[model samples]
Each structure stands twice: as C-alpha cells, then as structure tokens.
Target chain A: MTRKRFVTLTLIPAIGLLATLALVSIAGAIWFSVMNRTLRSADYEFVGLHNFLRLLRDRRFFNALENSIIWEAITVIGTLTLAVLLAVLIFETVKKPLWRNLICFAFLVPVLLPRVAAAFIWRFLYSPSLGVINYLCGLVGIGPVEFLANPSLALISVAVVDIWQWGLFFTVILLKLLETLPREPIEAAKLDSARTWEIHAYVTLPMLKGPLISLTLVKAVESLRSFDLIFVMTGGGPGTATETLDLYAYQMGINMGGRISYASAMSVLLLIVTTMAFVIIWKAGKKWTN
Target chain B: MANITCKNIVKSYGAHPVIEGLNLEISDREFVVFLGPSGCGKSTMLRMIAGLEEVSAGHIAIGGTDVTDLPPGERGVAMVFQSYALYPHMTVADNITFGLRRQGNSRAEIAPRLKQVADLLGLTPFLERRPKNLSGGQQQRVAMARAMIKTPKVFLFDEPLSNLDAKLREKLRTEIRKIHMQLKTTTIFVTHDQLEAMTIADRIVLMRDGQIEQMGTPDEIFERPRSRFVADFIGTPAMNFVRAEIRAGDELCASGGGLTLTLSPHSFPDLVAGQKVELGLRPARMELCGQNSHNAIHGTVVLVENMGAEGQVITNVAGAEVSFVTKDFRSLSPGDPVTFSIAPDHIHVFDPETGRSLRKD
Candidate 1:
C-alpha cells in the first residue's frame, strides 16, 4: 500500500474515535451544566451551611455516621480476609481445570444476584421464629433470638450479609491474580525447602501485597456504598441501627423524614472519603506494580 | 563426595514413556554430563535421580543408599534448574539460607554456611539484593550458592547455563568446572551442547530417543563412538557417511570406487562375501591423496568453507557429497578436481541396517 492510503486508513478511525469522544464529552458537559443550573434554581431553601451544621447537631445523623464507619470497617476487613482465604483455598484444592472453572463460576453467582433479592432471601433465613439459623439453634436448646429485629445485632447482621454477597466476587478476582502469578517463585520456594506455612507467610503472602491492598481498598469503597441490602432487610429499623451513610442519604434525599441538602452534603462527604481512599491505595499499588 | 548409581531406571507418564530403562553410574567426584538433542530425556533422567520424579522400575542409590522412593529434600541432592529458580521476593542471603534454616539448624550454624557459600560464589556483595535486582549471571550464582550451601551428596544441574549469552556461558562453564574440581562433589549435568559436555564433564553420556547410545570419557565419545548416533552428535561438523558394499575377490575392495583400495587381509575377515555396509569417516580423517592413486577416491570440490582457524572442503564423490575438514585454508576453488583417502585406522565400519559400529579386531 502507498504511504498516503496507509496514513488515511490509520488516521480515519483515530479521527472518528476522537470526534465521537469529543461529542460525547461535550454532551456530558452540557448535561452536568444543566443539572447544576437546575440544582441552583431548586426551591428547596437552605440557610448557608445550615444543613451541614444541622447534620452535625442531628443525633440520628451522628448515629448513622458512626454505624456507617463501623460497618465499612467490618465489611472491608472481613470481606478481604475471608475472600483471600477462600481464593487461596480454592486455588490450592481445585486441581481439575473444569472443576476450578466451575468453582470460580459458582462464586460469581452471588455477585450476579440482585442485592434486594439476596437480602430478601437472607431476611427469610434470619426470621426470628421461622429462620433456619434459629431452628438450628433450637436443636441446641437455644431461644429463638431476634436477628434484624434487635438493635445490637442489626448492624452486625447487615455487615455479615454484605460480606457474604460480595466476598465471593473479590475471591474470583483474587483467584485470577493468584493463578496468573509467576510459577517460578513458587517452585523456587519449594526447592528452598519452605514448608507450606512458611511459603504462605514468607513468599506467597508478600508477593500478594499489591493485589491484597487493591482488593481491600476496592471492597472498602463498595462496602461504604452499601445500601440496597440494608434497605430491603432491616430498612434501618430498631431505632437507627444499621443506618449507614448510603441509608442516611436515601432517607434524607428521597424520604420525607429528613432534609434534602443535608443528604447531598453527606453524599459529597462520602465522595471525598472514597476518593481519598482510592488515591492512597492507587499510589501504594502504583509503587508496587512499578 | 558421593557416587550415584542408576540401575535400570525408567520413567513413564501413564502410557507415554520418557526414559526407557536407563542404567548409569557416576563414581565419587566425577562430573558426568548427559548430552543429547532436545527431548532425549537427559533432564528427565537427572530429575529422576534427584528424586523429583518417580522412577517407574529401578533402584537409584546415592552414596550407596537406595533413595528412589525418597523425596528430593531427603535424597541428599540439590538441583540447579534452568530457570535459576531463585525466589523473587527473597534476598540472595535468605534464598541461600532457606534450606539450611528449614533443617532447623541454629542461627550460628546457618550463618557460617551461608557466608561461606556466598563468599565462594562471589555473591557476598549482592546478598542483600533480591533476585530480580541481580544480573542473570548473579542470579545463577545465587542459585548455585543456594544449592551448594547444603553440601548435598550429589549436585544436579539441569541446563543451568542455557539462559546466558555465549560469553557468559563460557565464563560460567569454567567457573562451574573449577567449583566442581575444588569441592569434588559428584555432579550430574544435563545439556544439549556437546562443547559444554566436552569442556566440563569427566564423562559424557550421549543419548538419543530416550536411550543412552554411549557413555565414555569425552575423548572416547569423540574418537571411538560406539554408534553412528554418537559420532554424529558429539562433533560439530559431523562425520560423513557413504554407502558402500564390501566386495568379494582375491582382495577386498569397495567396487563402486573409481580407484579401488585394498583392505587389510586381517581386517574385517568375518567376510560374508559381498555385504552392503555404510562407511563412516570423520572429516579430519580424509586426507588429500595424489590423483589417480590406488585407494584414493576422486572427486570434485564443490564448495570451500574457510571458518578462520579451519576450512571445510565439500566435494562430490561417487555421486555423493562429502566434507573434508582441514586446518590449512588452501585456496581451493569450487569444482576443482581432488582425490582423498581415509586413514585405514580411522575408517569406521557400521552395519547399514542397525546403525551400530562393527567391531573390528
């Protein structure tokens, strides 16, 4: 082919892609501009900083914020640790290629399930009288204790469900990372006479640092945005238990129970917190991958 | 430090056999090299001896103790793999000390051994550096140090220098030979390079098709190969073979030759009158003989290859092409008429059907 035709062939698609991207970005810019204008013109009157300052004074907001922090902490830590453990277990145990693929496929089922559907399923399982857990406990001669109904158990119950639903997704991703890791290092560790525990502690775990940190940060972000399951299961019931920031935002913005601007402020705060977390994790992961 | 004996060793993957019953013995402090083409099962044999692979039907003994069923760690053997197999996350020091530490040796005992091996391998300065930070040669040295730290009974090398450049390979080959000589550890190395086998091994085991064709000293394997496979594999510009029939008459001669050569009455006397055979002659064994001389084969030189120190003359003889290696880079042009004769003592006779050398009295 002549150089002119070759240049035209290459540049045409590049130019088309650039034009399409520019047009899309312009549309997005215009949409954001219109939304900002609409938000400015809204009749929801608010005193300057009054919503944010009032959120600070609101006892339920404080309670929801505290619960949200604890929920995120528990979910992120529990999800990452359990997911990594499950990934490693499946990786080591599942030898048949088809079986391994099937297990990974099985783990992705929970992630694909709608959060509300999963919450409803768990709500039935966590029912005070008819729940399987209570029935099993009754086998041991225990009382039919309340799960989502009790304030003390409600947050923990919600966190457990979040972990169950999302832990497998992280495990699937981490299993991929583990599988693609260089086999030479593992073989080297074996030749070095490293026992299984030492191999996990010294070689495998250290090498998994990047994936582990990234998985934790991503799970943290996902957990912080937890909403649907809690909404379906407990509905922030039993006097503000399990009222995470996402629940708080939903309550204030859409529910008639709280102010709208204050929820927007809370969403902005969440955006800042997640952004900072991502930046920190990104920098650390970048240092490692480099 | 140890003698390794492999008796009728065999390895098979389910129905596919990798090494068909092999027997080999290495005396104490001998550097034995398993040299062969790829897929010839040399490395497989080495791994079998290292107890890394299960031996199907044989007893492998190192230092006169049966170790065929033992694990690699318990076999008193250390192997340097082709990939160097250095732990990427650990520093050179930790990598070298890992095996020793695993033996539950105290820190004091491990430190001296680690320091000794590190210093011996010139890895002291790089002890703190991780494997990825080290050069290829340095990583290889660290692998050697790691293997050597245990002072195992037998050292197995699985093409450890194949990943390096030619210059580094040569340098490391010499270093390994020196180390072997100084330490006097019975070593078995596997490589496809005959030159490396010739340079480092006290004995070379030439294998083909998952079987050892010949095992002898390098000079023996090079000079008096027991089979055509060994002859073709051991040398660079391999030996030339020509199909010829032994003639029956008052005097034995190659009848197809323009000028017939008289064979010694005592040589090849078991004479089945006219037998079809293949004549083997090393390139160096064919000398330039006078034209029209008896016992000389006349041919025309087709190509002259001058490779600096040696020149190879390719000639057409009896409708077949044959090469003659010479140190004298004569200005022989292509298509020049030449006559050559094989040195009677160096002429190898092989049974055409079996490809095995004929035993001559």
Candidate 2:
C-alpha cells in the first residue's frame, strides 16, 4: 500500500468510532431537548424552547450554576497554587533523587485512590465526632466543626478534596518541567540581587506560564463536570448546598424529576462553554509561548 | 581599590578536592586570563573569586575588604556566563537594567545609564527585542551590557565566546579587550582556548592539576615556557618535542637525531654531560634552510598541510616525525628530502623525566 493509504486505513478505526459515538449522542440530545420528553409520560410532543425557558426561570438551576462557578474557581486556583508551591519547594530544597522521588510519591498516593473511594475517605475525615481532624482541632482549641454540613463550607470542603487529588499529581509534572528549565537564569537573578521569592515570582513563574495555563483549563473543565465526589460525600445535601450543575442536571432528569429534555439542554450548554474556554486558553497560550 | 587577594583558597566537593592551596594576587584594573586544559581548576578558581563557589579554606579580599562570606552581588562583581543567560521573556532593555531595577532603582533613574551602555556595546538597535529574537552574538553583547551597566569593580567571564563561530569569537575577543581597556575593571576570564588567552590577557595564569603551572605575560610564556605543559597548551601547531642528549663540547651542546645546537651556557648551568633532555622547538621558530646550512636537520617529507599564507610540513627524521611551519612555497611532495634550521636561543631544553625547563633565569 502507499504510505498515505496505509496511514488513512490505520486511523479509520479510532477516528470513525469516536466521531460516530459523539455525533449520535449529540444529535439525540438535540432532538430530545426540543421536545417535552419525560419518563413519566412517554407520548411526547414537540415543544420548541419550552424546556430552555423553564431553565431560565428555575431557581434550582440558578443555584446549581452559582455552586458550579464557586467550585471550579476555588478548586482550579487551589490546585494550581499548591502545584507551583510544592514543585518549587522540592526542586529547590530536596537534593538527592531518592528523597525527591519518595516525597513526590507520598503526595501522589491520593491520585491512585478512586474518586468514589476518596470521597468516602474525606467524608469520614470531616465527621464532627469520629474524625481525627476534629480531634486535632480540639488540640488547637478550635472545633467540633461541621466541615461538610455547613452551607457556606460545603462546596469549599468538597473542592478541597478535588484539590488534594489533582494538585500533587500536577506538582510532579511541574517538577519534571522545572528540571528541564535552564537554571542559569535563576542563578543570574540571584546575582542581580533578587531575593528567593522575587526570583520565583518574577522569573520562574513567568517562564512556566504556558504549562500552567494548559493545566488551569484542564482543571477547570474537570471541576465543572465533577459529580461522584459530591454524590458520595454530601449527596448535594443540607438543602442543595453542594448541588453543582452536573448533579442538578442528573437529579432533575433522572431522580427527582424526569425532565430528560431539560437535562439535554443543560448538557448542550456545558459543551458549548467548555469548547469556547478551551479555544481561548489554547490561543492565548500559543501567543505567549511563541 | 579593587585588587583581589586570594590566600590559600581551597575547594572540595565532599572529598574530591578541585582546587588545593591556590594563592594569587590580582592588581586593580588588571586583565588576567585563566588558561588551562579542560578539568583544570581555572573556572573553579574564577567562581571562587566571584563568590559563586564557596572556598573551603581561604581568605578572599576585594578592594581592601574581606568578601569571603559575601554574595556575588554584594561583592561588587558581575559575570557573563558561557550560555549568555538572559531572561527569555524580558526585552534587551529590561535585561540590561535588571540589576539596577532589582536593587530598587526606578525606570527614570536607569534610562539614561541603560542608553549609554547600550550605545557603548552597539546594542541600541536591539534594545527592545527579546533574547530569542537576537543572534548569538547580539545576545552575548546584551549579557555584557547587563554587566557593564552595573559598573562593578570586577568582571568575570566564563568562556563567554565558546558558543560563537570563529569570526564572531575573534571579533568579540577584540571587543572584550577594548572594553577592558576603556573600563579598566579588574577582569578575570576563564577559557581553555589558548588563542583567546594570548590575544586578550595582560597576564596569563596557566593552571594544571588544581595548581598554577606557570604565570607570565604572553611573550614571556611563548619565549620561555617553564614546563612542557605550558609550551604545549599555549600555542597553535603546538611546540614540537625531540629526545636529545647533552654533550660536552667547547660549550654545552644538545645533539640528537642528526641535529646539534649550542646551548646557552648561562641558561643551562646545571646540565652535565650525558644528561637526557627533551628539545622543544616551536614550529614558527624553525625556518626552511638549504642543505648545508648550520644547525640544520635533514628529513624526508611525510606530509604537507598547505595553507595560502603559511603551511605545516611534517617530516620524518631518524624514526621520529617533526613538523614545522614554512612560508617558503616550494613544489614539495611526499618522499622528498627537506632541511630546516632553528636559532640557538629558540631551542628549549627540559629534563625528560620531570618535564621542567632547564633554562635558568
């Protein structure tokens, strides 16, 4: 076979499978969203824009939107900040390869835990009476604290769980990237009288801009679509305190109300926003790196 | 005021000692080149002076102040690295003034000084471009401009031209000397390139095995090498060595391989009869001569490396090949007989085992 023909034949299985799965699901969703489809009443009628208009007036949908924004913002910022801090600390301080690798592995153990398993683990840790965290808090004279129960702390508490899993995973990646970065500029900054913090803030962080932006976008998308951690930990509990858009859409369509068309509309909205964000971030990163 | 004194400086990595008990004094505004083979302690010594590498046991004083514990910036020294480590995201202007800006100088305070240094280094045109956009030579100038703008008491260059092409290296070498002449900073440059050391250094400190092998001016080093390593490391078409034996004649003479030369009696006063020595002859010092000329050696041409201005002719003499540079363009091919003569003073004598020059001062 010609090289081009062989390449095309090799790519067809993966490309064709992915394209078919995505197109069929999106077409089905679009079709269902325009009709008043419900599990309770199977005889559906075409009702254009009616479900979308219901979403516009739905108080639960607005509450889920607010919760998702807070969750994604806090989670992405916290994860990225910890990644930079830990990566720089280890890169600068840890001398031997054996120690560096061991430290990184300890932080990475959380990533090996399944998200559902991690949710259960965090739920126990946040328990007011049985948790060792509360026991330590008592030593500090602070709490029998309601970590997952209080309305103001529920989303942040869950966001911290996501941060714990992803932040260290990215720290290892950033540390490897730091190894590839030329260290002479940092040394030159030292001779320029840059304090240690100034060198990292001005020189090292600016150099890592491209990778950090890409990580930020990925973390944003992952936090927005997160559902299992909240499901196992709070079940969007304490009166919808941790109900993100993903969990709200699922609960509205499947559990509490069988409004499948409305959930499809919410999925479509999420897809559009994610694609726009990815393109913008990718473009800005390209401009900066080049 | 910026004269440097290093007293018994020693550097070690755990137990591996790199520099051991090295002591030297550098005068204010003196340009010294640390010349050596790779793995010699030239760069380590330079770093010790810059306070980048801490000396294990020594006292270092700069400008009459003990700066052994000071940082590089606080020691009033700046360095141009081998790789030209300019901040990639910063523009030429920003990089040049980074030192002043970091020291809390405002933009308006540094603008006039930056312009002056940029114009001095011919970097005014590239002041706004990033380092990635500039050529290798241009980036090197930016590194120099960064140092020059600081107006420090000492300038340390660690093989700053090793990355450039030949023509660019030569150009920058001359420009660096000119900068030294103009600024008169106490400069210490480290390079394994002997030509670079020869062209730019007011004094060459040739090092070997973590110690000073020889130290002198360029002409003193070339004319009177104190050891075999200095003669070999400091010349292009390096100085040739031939085994010889000292003989008692009317005066002391070195005779070997159908060649004999009258040695200066004042130079080799310790040499007795039947002493084995190595006769060192520079290729540039030997001249092509006629068959019957005095102090001439006869050989068969083994190979000829022909350049337009000058060429090196490798000739076989008594089972040893001796090469010499000749400006005499003749139609010479392999298997042809050749004769070359050397002046009596140009013949260097060294003890074969110790490799130390026998010439007494």
Candidate 3:
C-alpha cells in the first residue's frame, strides 16, 4: 500500500472514532435533556425547556448548587494552602534527605488509599460515639459534636475529607515544581535581605503562579465532579446538606425517582459550569504567564 | 565604603573540607578579585563573606563589626550572582527596589535611588519591563542595578560576567570597574578568567585547593609569581615547565632535555649542587634567535598559530614541547628548525618536590 493510503486509513479512522465518541456523548445529553424522556416508559414527547425551567425554580436544586459551589471553593483553597504550607515545611526545611522523603511519604498515605477506602476511614474517624476524634475532644472537655450528622457541619466535614484525600496530590506536584525553581533567584533574595516569609511571598509564589493556577483548575474540576467520598460518607445526609450537583444528578436520574431527562439537564448544566470555570482559569493563566 | 576582613575562615561539608583556614583583609574602597579555576573555593569564600554560607570556623567582619553570625540581610553587603538572578516576575524597577522596600523605605526615598541606579545601568527605558523581556546584557545590568541600589558596605560578585558572551563580558567588565571607582565600595569579585582579574582588580588573590596561592598586584603576580602553581595558572597559553638539574661548578648551569643554560649568580642563593629543579618560562618572553646566540635552544617547529597581531610557535625541543609568541611569523612553518633564547632574568626556578619557587628576590 502507498504511504498516503496507509496514513489516511490509519490516522483518520482513529481520530474520527475519538471525535465521534465525544460528539455523541455531548449530543446525546443535549437531545435527552430537551425531550420528555423516562427510563420506565417508551412513549415520550419533546418538552422544550421544561426540565431547565423547573430546575431554575426548584429550591432543592438551588440548595445543591450552592452546596457544590461552596464545596469546590473550600476544597480548592484549603487543599492548595495546606499543600503549599506542608510542602515548604516538610520538603524545604528538612535538611536530611531520608527524613524529608519519609515525611513526604507519610503525608501521601491518604493519596495511596483508594478513594472509597479513604471515605470509609474518615467516616469512622468522624463517628460521634466511637471515633478517635470525638474521644480526643472528650478528653479536652468539649462534648461529642456531630460532624456528618449536623446540617451546618455535614458539608464542611465532607469538604474536609476531600481536602485530606487530594491535598497530597497538590503537595507532590508543587514540591517537584518548587525543587525545579532556579536557586539563584532565591539566593539573590536572601542577599537582598528578604525574610523567609517575604522571600516565599514575593519571589517563590509568584514564580509558582503558572503551576498553581493549573493545579487549581484541575483540582477544582475534579472536586466539582467528586462523588465517591460523599456517597460513602454522607449520602446526602442531614436533609441534603452534603448533596452536591453530582450526587443530586445521580439521585434524580438513576436512583429512586428516575427523572432521566431532568438528570440529563442537570448534568448538562454542570458540564457548562465546569467548562466555564476551566476557561476562566485557562485565560487567567495565559494572562499571568504572558 | 568599609573594609572587609576574614579571620581563619574554614568551610566544610560533611566529611569533605572545601576551604581551609583562610584569612584575608581588604581596606576601604579596595577592589579585590579572587581568581581560581572551577571548584577552587573562590565562590565559597565570596559566599561566606556575603553571609550566605556559614563559616565552619573563624570570624568575618565588614567595616568594624564582626558579622559571622549575622543573617545575610543584616550583614550590610550585596551580591550579584553569576546567573544574574533577576526576578522573572517583577519589573526592572521592582527588582531593583525590592531590598529597599523590605527595609521599610517609603516611596519618596526609594524613587530617586531607583532612578539613579536605573540611569547608571542604562535601564531607565526597561523599568516597567520584566526580566524575560530584556536581553542577556540587559538582564545583567538589572542584576547590577539591584545590587547597587542597596549601597552596602561591600559588593560581592560571583563570576557575574561568566554567563555573558565575550563582547558583553568585556563591556560589562569595564562598566563594573567604573562603578567600583564611582562607589568606592570594598568589592570582592570572583572569577577564573585571568584577563578579568588583571584588568579590574586593585589586587588579585589567586587561590588553589582552598588556600591562597598568591596575593599581589596584577603586574607583581605576573612578573614575580611566588610558586610554580601561580606561574602556571596566571598566564594565557600557560607558562612552560622544563625539568632541569642544577650543576654547580665555577659557573652555575641548569640543563634539561639536552639543552643547557647558565643562570644568574644571584638567581637562587640557597641552591646546592646536584639539586633537581623545574624552570618556568613565559611564552611571550622567549624570542626566536640565531643558532649561535647566547642562551639559545634548538628545536623543530611542530605547529604555528597565527593570532592576527602575533603568532605562537610550538616547537619540539629535545622531546619537550616549548611554545613562544613572536610577531614575525612570515618565516615560520611546521618542520622548520628554530632556535630560541631566554634572558637569565626571565627564568624562574622551582623546587621539584614542593613546587615552590627558589628565587629569593
């Protein structure tokens, strides 16, 4: 066979297959959202904007949207902040390489565990009666406080669990980036009389802006679509306090009341929100880098 | 505007000692260049002085105060790194004024100092631009501007021009000299380039194996090196070494590689008969001579290098390669027999065991 024919047959088919899969997934969601469809009945009708309009007015949908936004915001900020602090404290300050590696490895235990396993472990720790956290709190004279059972604390408890599981992800990535930073600028800062905190603030963090933004965008999107931990831990407990957009869509579409069309609409809206978030971060990253 | 002093400074890492028992003193406004090859501890000495490296033992003082234990910011010295270490995210103005801002200088005070430094380094136009937007030379200038704005007691430069091209290195070398003259700050510059040390330093401190081999003015170090290492290290194309045995008779004669030459009576006062020594001869000092000329050595030309204004002739003289520079290259070619002569005063004798020069004067 000629080179041109081989290239056309091989490359085009692979690319066409990927493009077709992506296009179908997106087009199928939009099509099902616009039609009155159900899993139980074969008969259906085109209902323009019915599911979206109801979604806009539904208080439970609004509550889930707010919870998702808060969850994403807290997870991204908390994880990044904790990751940077821990990486700098453990990796940069520790002089012995063996000790540094040991500490870093210990901190990465959560990441090594499966997400569902991590959720189970955190659920046990957050147990109000027999958990270590409440036991320690009891010793400190504070009464046993409900972590995942209280309406006010359920969302935060789930967010904390997400932060614990993923903060190490940022720590490993940012630590590698920190190690690759040119030492001369840091030494230059030292000679210029910059204090430790000031050096990190003015020189180190600014240099890390590109990687930090990219990581934040990635983690933000990941947190937005997160389901396994919240499913295992809270399961939208305490009257929908921890019910995020992902969980809410799963419940509406696949669980007891299978409003498949309405679930498809919610998923489409979530996709739009995540895409918009990614675009904003990407644009901000480009602007800062340039 | 202050003197700097290092007393018995030693730096070591783990079980390996890098700099050993070093001491140096620089008077006010004196420019000293520490010259050595890579890994010779010149940079380590400079970093120690800047308070960036902790002294393994001993004390350092800037001006009159001992600053050995002080943090780098409180030591009152500024350093320009070899990489030019300009903050990539900051504007030129911000990079220059970062230290001043940290010192709590208000905008009113920082503005003029920033402008003055920018003007001195010709960085006024690029004040608002980031370091990446500038050329290599411009980035170097920004590094200089950053260091100069502090106006500390001393300036430390760690091979600041090593990263630049030859032409820019030469230009910046002269600019640095001018800045030193204007500021009159006790400056310590470290470099391996002999030309840079010779051209810019008031005194050159040549180091080897973590200890100072020689410290003197450029002309003194060039003309009268204290040891074989100093002679070998300071000259371009390097000085030649020929193993010779001293023969004492009515006239003292040194012979090596089938060539013999008479030495001056006072060349080595402590010399004894049958002592083995090494003779050092600079390439530029040897001259092509006729076969019957006094102190002439015969050799066959192996290679001829034409260096525009002058040519270097590398010749095989009695199984030893001897190179000399000469302006008259018209009659030279490979395989041609040549004779060269060196004056008695130009010859340097070193003890073969210790590599120390035997000359008393």
**lDDT score for residue B30 of model 2:** 96
Question: How many clashing residue pairs, candidate 1?
Answer: 0
Per-residue lDDT for A145-257 in model 3, tens only? 89999999998988898888789767877776888899989988998888888888899989998888888888877887678889999998788999988889889889957
Candidate 2: residue pairs that collide = none
lDDT of 1 by residue, A1-290 (tens): 99999999989998999999977855543333222222334443325555556667889878888888899888998888788789888877887889988988998898899888899888988897789989998999886878898899988987888888788888888888888877656655666666756766777777888778777777876776678888888888877888887887788766854445566666666666767867887887788765
Question: After superposition on all CA atoms, what RMSD does each candidate show versus the true structure?
Answer: 4.6, 1.4, 2.0
DockQ, prediction 3:
0.83
For each candidate, give the TM-score of chain B.
0.93, 0.98, 0.98
Q: In model 3, how many backbone clashes occur?
A: 0
Q: What 10-residue stretch in candidate 1 chain B is worst by lDDT?
A: B254-263
Tell me the docking grade of candidate 1.
acceptable
Evaluated at residue A84, the lDDT of candidate 1 is: 75
How much does each candidate deviate at the interface, measured as C-alpha RMSD after superposition?
2.0, 0.9, 0.7
TM-score of chain A of each: 0.79, 0.96, 0.93
Candidates' lDDT values, in order?
0.80, 0.89, 0.89
**For candidate 3, what is the DockQ-based docking class?**
high
* lDDT, candidate 2, A1-290, per-residue tens: 99999999999999999999999999998898899888898799999988888888989889988888888889999999999999989988997999988988898899899999999999999999998888999999999999999988888888899999999999998998888889788878878888778888888888888888788878877787679999999989778999988899899789978989999888777778778977887898788777
Runs of candidate 1 exceeding 4 Å displacement: A1-46, A140-145, A150-152, A288-290, B106-108, B249-271, B292-295
Q: Please give the distance, in angstroms, between residue B247's alpha carbon in candidate 2 and its true position after superposition.
A: 1.2
